[model samples]
Target: MVSLRKVPGAHQHPNLPGKVKVEEDVNSKAVPVDQETMPTIIQTVKEDLGELKKFYNITLSPTRFQKVEHYLEKKLEELSNITFGKLNQAGQVDYALLNNYLKSSLQRLRSDKVKDDEVLKLVGSFAFIIIELFEARQRIQKLDFQEVAALFTRADNSARDLKQAISSGIFRGKIERTIAYRTAYKLEELSSVLRDWHNFYLGYEPLYSWWVSQPYATFQENLSILIACIQTDLVGFDDSVKDPIIGEPIGRDGILADLDFEKIAYSPEELIHIGEMEYQWCEVEAKKASCEMGYGSDWRKALEHVKNMYVGPGQQIYGIHDLAIEATNYVKDHDLVTVPEIAETWRMLMISPERQKANPFFLGGNTMQVSYPTDKMSHEDKLMSMRGNSIPLSRSTVFHELIPGHHLQFHMIKRHRPYRRIFDTPFWMEGWALYWEFILWDKGFPGTPENRIGMLFWRMHRCARIIFSIKFHLGEMTPQECIDFLVDKVGHERATATGEVRRSFNGDYSPLYQAGYMLGALQLYALRAEVLQSGQMTEKEFHDKVLHENEMPIEVLRALVRNFPIDPDFRPSWKFYEKN
Candidate 1:
């Protein structure tokens, strides 16, 4: 059955988020039940944490933090008791994933607490007062309405006073100002939490309402005003410039930790080098395409020409539909992978002007959303939209969104070992879609030189993402620098480049999300070569096997596909790609 699910700590706009899995009729004798790989303890811990998180909803609640930490520690001890060597291959994979998940969760909780403390230092005791109220309410303690009302008054006055200090140049340094801005956002969340708690008892308990209603309203208003003040005065961002790219650079250590969590065998520098190497290959191929297009060696000119090849106004959707059909037929004819008829059936929708700010391209699953000019857009914006979603560019990725990309990926995952969905990584999800682009390009799917350029352009963009995103997280690249890199290096439209950088650093995505596209594709590409060379599986079987295995780190997937022995203490040691 279809159901709404929350990915724990999923805070970003994913590459292809929100695809509803169509239920499979497993009652049919033809449908075989997939083997269960997830260990019982892993499932139990996942379920327990999901429940605990629902009740402990407050972000900065000390009680919630303590309980989660203790719970994780207990779970770790229980997991350690399992016999790792006795488990089957899939069971071993699950064990490793569970161990990593438990450790990573603990690390994240501790890290979040450190950040919360830093933000609290800037925000003051007022935030803690609001947190205390939520905690007390959750405890079902008898309300001391007058005392609680007095606390709200103190919080409101203190919040207003803090705003005045910030206005008077209290936080002058850039780092201090950044912290203040973060505190402002944290206070905004606190304001919402307080409002929820306030509404819970607002009119339900007459005594509480009489004593606390006005104070609660006053405190909430003061919190909003403070948030606005921090945004406008400290951060210099108002409504007109609402989406300023103020990303939190996780630094080198953070990047290293993230790499470990993703089970990536390479170091941050090595990954960037891989990106650069791949980018250089794209550049060489792009020059060849440019030459064929009569643009000499200057690929930028070739890119501009390709961009201007947009279909007539109001005809973008039909072009997309035709491309989807073409791509689906080509894959089926080639026997690349099985495409269920249902995967080909997708409804079309137009992206809103606002969403186009972050995702200025196509997104697909059960529904394919097209990005093109609308009547509400300005002339310049409309032109940019059309240019960005040109026929050539769209052709390169039509299959990436539909058919062998997101649509097929989502369809197969549901019918397979769906319980492993919790272990999903962008490296597999986005990487699988991106890998098709590589294979199709190798098979000469990009027919014309302009089409080749289109494919190369996205390949170059993916490589650039790896560079800029990794560098940005490692504190080597600023958001503005990243935008400039895309524009100057990858031949991106200035507006499109800006949107990309904004999306990358807006804390909506994990640090390595952008890098996942190309790097992930490379991982899969290497695996395919290994599998084929060893005669382990034919081409079609290799492709189909991946989808049925559901989502995991590519490294983990590699171990599964290759039938390598996995241990409970498994560390990522597979260097899938070697530098040429």
Candidate 2:
């Protein structure tokens, strides 16, 4: 889920990444965070993520003109005051984060050229509404269906009013049209969310008794009408359902460049050939590794042996925590990269059932969420989870998700130019973590042939992700075909393979995300070969510097790390992958 669970890649960093998070999240000076509100805060922010769904929704309309300018300014000034107020170092960081984020948001909102005002309005509204809803959900009597219906009724009326506003011809031009469209989109999205919650709560007798009464069209029905309006002739947007807000099909050259292969000078067809070759070569290596481990080239048996070591009698959680600690110690001993003091306090939590589908592996940054099955899972689910994540598999992931990976990235992002956290892509997020797998492989991290095979298994999976994602987006491969490719070519457990595909298309991930793991890592590997391998910088220096730079496209990252001449208006022209 590091990148794949993205939209849902499903992480809601309790600390998120940047300026606004600092202001809105850190609730108190003495306490730093209000315990009672923290869970609600985290969950609400995730729900607020809905505000980011439709890019057109960010555009504003003249009809929406309000006195919000003064309010935003006042709120920003108050946040700035918090930053200057006296507090402990931790509290100071939070205050500063909030102050900076609000300042940035305020500046953007004031820009009439950029409709960030509308963006903030909706985003802010979502933030407030989520908190209010969180509190309401807690107080509502479980059996009181009317109370739940009241929440829907409030949302429905907003929809009805907005529908009439658009139909009334208040929206005339592009800007006004965009504003109306976005408002409609948001209302529909929120309505859909409420409908899901209602269905979830309807199972209980208390709620069920109230549900049997009279009802009109559901919120979903109202949302459907609004959707038709915005998506159809009532109003239109540059973005379509196929073209997601953050995603655009970049075609072959773009894919190559993104993977740091702009200079490879190979045709897209050539790249496909190379990928197939790599896939085949890995198969040979996998069998060879199994043979060396006395499994007689049975790759499955070899992997199973390692898995059974961790899966214990009568169902235990395995040694995931111990393994992470061990990996942490290993990194500290090797000085692979700086694991700051902040990482010391980072906690490892089990993945929740609700999240496991999107994040079948793990999600980590400040906190490492292990993907092992909980006590609530069925035996079959537990078995598949165990087999898929066995010891060697987890070895790569633990290091990938914790130290030298997300946790370190998160720690550094907070310490560095926190504002830079705004620019996010899988290139840096998942790529950095994936790069370590390559780095560790080269340094002989997998001491035994069996270990090598396990590592190779993951390596193959990464490669396969690239090939399948490319093929799928190009209209050459279907999702089911992609799934078959993983299970067949990579030897992935069937259930686990399905989860990987699900993560790729989970409605929030970029089309290229599945491919990003290997491609991004390859780019970093190529960059290191250019500078670090040439003794321009030691491994420790290179890794540490990369982290402090925060996340961005690998091309831009290369420009920064290499000290390449970057004009004010910089563009990526570098091809770091020509060699490979």
Root-mean-square deviation of every model: 9.0, 13.6
For residues 1-580, could you state the per-residue lDDT of candidate 2 as single tens digits?
0110123232132212111111122222333333323223223323333333221122232212222344335544444433233444323333333343344345434544244355335333232332233223333412234543554465556556655665565544544444445555555555555454455555554544464222324545655665665544444534434322211233554455433322233445655665676677777878888888889878877777766555653333346676677777877899878887757677767777667765677677777777777778889888777777777777778778887777778888888755446545676789898899888888888888867877888888888987887876565776668779988888777777877887786446865677668767878998888886678788889888788766656766676667654332234465555534
Against the hidden true structure, what lDDT does model 1 obtain? 0.82
Please report, as a residue range, the 10-residue window in candidate 2 with the lowest summed lDDT: 15-24
Q: Write the per-residue lDDT of candidate 1 for residues 1-580, one digit (tens) a residue.
A: 1112333453212211222222222122221112333545556676777877777787776656877887888767766766677778888888888788889889989988888788877675687677656755664546567767777888889889988987887665644545656777787788888888988888788878888899988988888888988887787676876577777777788888878888898899999999999999999999999999999999999999999999978999999999999999999999999988777778999999999888888888878999888899999998898999999999967889888998899899888877677777889989999999999999999989999999999999999999999998887887889999999998888788988998888778888899999889999999999999999999999999999988888888899999988767668888877777
Q: What TM-scores do the predictions have?
A: 0.90, 0.60
TM-score of 2: 0.60
Q: Alpha carbon lDDT of residue 156, candidate 1? A: 86
Which pairs, if any, clash in model 2? 5-9, 5-10, 6-9, 19-101, 20-101, 22-98, 23-98, 263-575
All models: lDDT?
Answer: 0.82, 0.59
The weakest ten consecutive residues by lDDT in model 1 span: 24-33
